[model samples]
Target: MIDKTTQPALQRLRLNLRQLEVFLATARGGSTRAAADRVARSQSAASTALAELEAALGCELFDRIGRRLQLNENGRALLPRAQAIVDQAFEAQDLFLGEHAATLRVGASFTIGEYLLPGLVSRWTQLHPRSLIQLRIGNTSEVLDAVAAMDVDIGFVEGSQTHPDLVMQSWGHDEIVVIAAPGHALAQQCATPQQLSQATWVVREHGSGTRQVTDEWLLGHLEQVRIGFELGSNEAIKRVVAASDGLGCLSRHAVEQSIADGHLIELATHLPKARRKLAIVLHREKKLGRGASDFLAHCRAAAAF
Candidate 1:
């Protein structure tokens, strides 16, 4: 296997934005025709661009099985770098259009994106009327990946673990509370381990920060609890818990409105209160632009937890 790091740097100079863009579009939409539509180019042009890009990079980026293209091992390895390059180019352009009229690209995990960031973004916008705020929402891992790749100026995440390539700044503390519908059997009483173990659980889908924390905190204690359903979003989980007899563990911020409206009830568990740090993440080597720095400062000063 050829070590990519050992490759000549000259190959990098041969890369063009159009080629990378075509490569990305083809990789994502899985065909040159689709890629052509995305990049507004002829199908033959997209195909030629991808082929030239692969040749310049010294490896085939995709496996051509009949007319369908799939990312091979080499393609998979190059995809992140290609995405980072393309996204960073756009971000750089946006950032340099005007320093004070800066455009900030922010990525956020589910909890912060849905509940916390709107207010912060609003406040930031008020402070800097000329500033542009673009927000991307994903699970903790996805947000972290975006930061590490320099796709976002910064990220807000609720997961306990931090990546080696990223730096995490303590933003605030969040409580992870177990909850249920008001009519649930355990809703009105403190639930013991055995009693909790028997109740069905509805949880955020696997990649979610909430799911990770629950695995570490809840499952660690009630090792054998039944998981009745695994849901994709915190809102979905909340809705399921509120309408059904199942129980769920989620961030306090996520369920505050539901709990207040009597759609859900925060349960008293035998275990101690579960809390985790919410953090702002960025690549360790990232040099923050003025806009990013300003927003980071605002986050540090504002008490949102």
Candidate 2:
């Protein structure tokens, strides 16, 4: 039923994984030689594959300037789809070897990475002993960027931040607690709004999920508060608050161990309880590999209880 002329066109339309892989490598590395090094092919072969892809697509995907190849409109449009296809191919290949043979790349905000993911990752690795996970830790904004750029397969973060390119799913919930050293003035008292507003606070740095929540919760209740320190690390804030008279606000998970050790005390304050939703984020266009998909399932199952 097919014509001979149409059959040749259909064959030309077929795009191969090797072409896409080379395309991705070139887009990332910016040169045929770099693409060659990345995909373990010769520079000339990489160039030939790229030319074939452009010819098949009937458009130039990049803008050439001297030795640099920058993604133009067509390339930009094709990048995500190409990435998904290549990723799916690798995932499918790994599937037959065993579920544990695939590698997963995950990104997480500081609070989730340091306090929450450890136990979950520990449990997951135990079950899939041969699986490898590369976890990158950053703040909420950084996690969003990594997920958007496909630097990681998935992301877990705290608070209510959203990215246009990502799909956010509520994973769980967390509570933010106000803390003080056991010997601090507020440790044994139910602090009033006026006292809290006057107190020196040690809080998470800007761009942090905890910091965003802290600002919203505290500012909503108190007219104005003084920030004594803005730190990147939860542990650093805890230590500063414990050694000084400054108050601290952090996740209950981050502070629980210190609270239990009698080094820090959860403050009784007049402000309302602060709670936030934890979320799992993934690129809207991304197709999850089996290992990453299974890991996501594992996390969801754990969060159910």
- Write candidate 2's Cα lDDT for 1-305 as tens digits: 89987997888566999999999989888999999999999999999999999998999999999999999989978988999999888877887887768678899999899988988999999999889899999999999988987778999999888999999998999999999999998777899999999999999988899999999999999978799999999989999999999999999999999999999999999888999999999999888877888899999998841
C-alpha lDDT of all candidate models, in order: 0.86, 0.92
Residue 150 accuracy (lDDT) in model 2: 78
TM per candidate: 0.74, 0.86
Q: How far off is residue 228 in model 1, in Å?
A: 0.5
After superposing candidate 2 on the true structure, give the runs of residues whose Cα lies further than 4 Å from its correct spot: 1-10, 25-56, 62-72
Q: Per-residue CA lDDT of candidate 1, range 1-305, in tens?
A: 87888687746588899999998888767899999999999999999999899888899988999888998989877766776676667657767565546568899999999999989889888887888889999999899988875568799999776798788988999999999999999877899988888889999877788999898887788858688999888998998888899989999999999989888889998988889889999877666766778888988888668
Error of 1 at 246 (Å): 1.3
lDDT of 2 at 164: 92
